[model samples]
Structures are given as structure tokens and as C-alpha cells.
Target: MTHSLDPAALDQLFLQARTFNKFTAEPVGDDLLRQLYDLYKWGPTSMNTQPGRVVFVRTEEGKQKLKPALMPNNVDKTMAAPVVAIVALDTAFYEHMPTQFPANPAARDLFASNAGLSTDTATRNSSLQGAYLIMAARALGLAAGPMSGFNPTMVNEAFFPDGRWKANFLINLGWGDPSGNRPRGPRLAFEDGVVLA
Candidate 1:
């Protein structure tokens, strides 16, 4: 499906999606979360070799399991958020590359025999997907808090055993409490961060 976003309108969503440190004691509905996932899962991936695997920590038990995995500063806010998503990369993402990258048989063989190549592709593509998920959530009028301070090994052990998934990052989702938002952080200016040829 061909889709396009108006740059100006997209910027508005970017402006709204700020880090939410606090949230109301409200819960996000499972159906809404599912819808969000459905939308995000369709975002582009390298060769369409989708590598993202999301573990939604919604239940009290699941949230409790996440506590031991989060850094001290992130634990309380994570627990309080309506949803904490554990975004992971599937190590075997390329197994289906024959179909996803069918245009070139070489694409299928590219990572088939090399463990390092498979791992690198999965990590990079899943990271890209995670960013798309954040934008999709923002477009849906949801607040997001993206974080990297977490124990990946612990998260994998708690959520995925047998090495099926590798944790990438954690994103808390819910309606924002204006009182919980941090001031917009400074960003590098275009000239400072980007160069045009």
C-alpha cells in the first residue's frame, strides 16, 4: 500500500510526542494496543524481512517481571505506565527472506550462512521498526516514553526463553499527564546535524 504523510502535519505529531514521565492511573485497552501493533507491524523493514517482535507487558504479573529488568530510575515509571512494550528482534528473521526478498535469490543467501550477518540485519531492521512504532503511536494520539536503560538479558529471560527473541528497547505507552511531561529538550539545528551535498 502506498502511503504518504504531509511533512507539516507529520511535524505536528512529532511536536506532540514528547517524553512522558508521569501518567494518569488509567489503563490502555487491549484492543487499542492491538490496533496500534497492527498498524506498526506494517511499517517498512529491510527486504521486508520483518524482524520485530513485541512483548506487551500489560498484566500485573508481566509488569512485575519487568521490574528486575529495568534500571532503578525507570522501574517506577514503567510500572505505572498503562503499557510497557518490550521490542525485540527475531534472530531467525531471515529464514523467510526467500519470500520477502524474492526479487533476488542472492538476497536470501546474503545472510543465510553467516550468523553475524543475520544478527546485524535483525538488529538494524528491528531498531528501524521500533522508531516507526513510536511515530505510529504518536499519530494515534498516544503518549510514548522511549528508553534504553534496561537489562536486555534479563528481559529476554523473562519474556523469551530458548533464544527466540533479543530485546531492543522499552517503550511506555498511554495518555500523557501534562504535569508529567518534561520540557522539550534541545535538538541540533539542521546545519549542525545534517549536511547537504
Candidate 2:
């Protein structure tokens, strides 16, 4: 069996991690963002259909383009963050299934033949990848503020004008300023939220 992670590792990844509202003035470099993607991409998706796509908006110009799409509450904090990741889903992701799921060359055709199944798989897998992105950022010592308050139409028009990809959510990434953190909230117990077979 795989050994359990140490307490400190657990704390960093889950126990003590916070969804930061503000960040330090320091920038998040391209190298670290690359590393973050490298780490998170290892997470599994059904039939290896990795449908998640991300656009990292770091430049002033890009942020300006994104600004009009954001909700009023999300605008300020997102602008203040070093980088904002627009996590997206590619509806045409199945086109790559032939190579991605090589063991089953028929997979691409399977999804292509059924648009509903293709969309469902793409959405579910991309959402899972967005969660993996946050965990990967935590593992790499960055704080992530994941939010879903933007107008999808506005965001899509601004970022994915061609319409191949759709926004799943957004995450603000940076070195956190602890003073901006809210008091930790409570979670539901397993017994209340989960069911045993």
C-alpha cells in the first residue's frame, strides 16, 4: 500500500490551506505556472480524455479584456491577483481521443458519434481538472481563490471568440497575504454529506 503523506504535507494541501482573497506584490512566474500544469496534468480522466483547458491572464491588457466579464465582487480581487486562470472545457476535446486513449483507437469515434455523451464527459472531466489545479497550486506553495461568478457569455466572447472552448470557472493565483483571509468556515460531517453502501 502507498504510505500516507506526513501531517505537514496534509496541512499544506488541505487542512490549513485557504482560498485567499488577497496576495503579495510578488509575481507568479511562467516557470511556476508551467510546473503547476505539469503536476496537475497527471490527474486521470475517463478514457484519458483530458478536456480541461486554461488561459492564464497575467498581463495588464489581458486583465483589462477580462474585466468586463467579471462580476462586480470578483473584479477587484482578481485584478489584484498575480494571475487569473480561466479554466475551460473544450467541446471538441474528443478529436484527440485517438492519440490520448491509444489503447482504444475507437474512442474518438465513440464520442464523435454521440454529441450528448461527448459534452457530458468533457464537462465532468474539465471540472475535475479545475479542482486538481487548486490542489497542485497548494502543493507548490501557492494560494488559489477559485470562483465562478463571471458572466459566461461575456467571458466566452472575450476569450474564446471562436466558441470551441467554454469557461468552467476562474482561479486567482499568487502568494497569499494571510491578513486578507477570512475566518475558516465549518464543513459538513461525512455522515451528513456522504452515504455508505
Best by TM-score: 2
* Residue 183 alpha-carbon offset, candidate 1, angstroms: 1.5
lDDT of 1: 0.86
Report the lDDT tens digits of candidate 2 across residue range 1-197: 49999999999999999999999999999999999999999999999999999999999999999999999999999999999999999999999988789999899999999999999999999999999999999999999999999998899999999999999999999999999899999999999999998
TM-score of each: 0.90, 0.98
**In candidate 1, which residue ranges exceed 4 Å CA deviation?**
1-8
lDDT for position 103 in model 1: 86
lDDT of each: 0.86, 0.95
Per-residue lDDT of model 1, residues 1-197, tens digit only:
39866786577477555888878887889988888988888888878889988888888999998899889999889999999988899988877778877887787677778889789889999998888888888877788889999999999898888897999999998888879777788999999999898
